[model samples]
Target: MSESRLHLHLHFHFLSLLFLSCVSPSYFSTTNPDDNSYVACGPHQAQVLTEFMNEFDSSHCNLSDPYNGVWCDNSTGAVTMLQLDDCLTGTLNPNSRLFMLHHLRYLDLSHNNFISSSLPSKFGSLNRSYPKRAHW
Candidate 1:
């Protein structure tokens, strides 16, 4: 291969690796159950999550599956990360209990069937201390 082509390929490969690293669920995970210092998710937060789960059809969801991740803050026990991709069906209601999770820093609800649901105004009320990333 030409030198320029080889260099371009290497750059593309590096960028792909970087993107994969950034998107890996384990990179931001804090929910390791075997750790002695692992903090349990707070009752209120857990209840809210349960209510949110109930609002949708979750036949695909494995509540005990670590890949359907939920990470709570070590000190406060507040949910900080949630990843429920492909696990839910049906529209996300406007008054979803999901909006009540004010402590979430990372939330990935991707690949769900929320096409019919409108964006809730309560999205503006969520914790915004972290930078937002909206793909569409």
Candidate 2:
């Protein structure tokens, strides 16, 4: 497989592991090295999510880390909701890294400027485990 495909595959599995952590903890062990690293959400996703959060702050619309509008799980630092509705971001491009947030269950991209842009097809691939509701 190509490098991009590898990333997508890893992203999918990593997200699935994260969901498992929230649902079935038996199969998702943070104490184990291999299992722990599999769902780490690492630097790439952190960078992407951090950038997205900074770019799309609902209150101030400023770019800052540790910003508001990010809801992460306590047990897992994986981001589950990016509440960016009523944000000031101008547009979402086809290549926007937002689709990489596979673990997200509540994404509020409404009221943003998606002019001339449509949601990426991969966004449909994102899913949440049982009991975790997904709302756009």
| Best model per lDDT | 1
TM-score of 2: 0.50
Instruction: Evaluate residue 94 in candidate 1 and report its C-alpha lDDT on the 0 to 100 scale.
Output: 74
Return the TM-score for candidate 1, rounded to 2 decimals.
0.64
How would you encode candidate 2's per-residue C-alpha lDDT over 61-111 as one tens digit per residue? 432323234454435656565544433333344465566666676665444
Every model: Cα RMSD to truth: 12.4, 13.4
Please identify model 2 stretches exceeding 4 Å from their true place: 1-45, 53-66, 127-136
TM-score of each: 0.64, 0.50
lDDT of 1 by residue, 1-136 (tens): 4433333322332222122222232332345434635556666776666666656556555534432356778778787766555545555557777777787776666555453435567656554733453211
**Residue 37, candidate 1: how far off, in angstroms?**
5.4
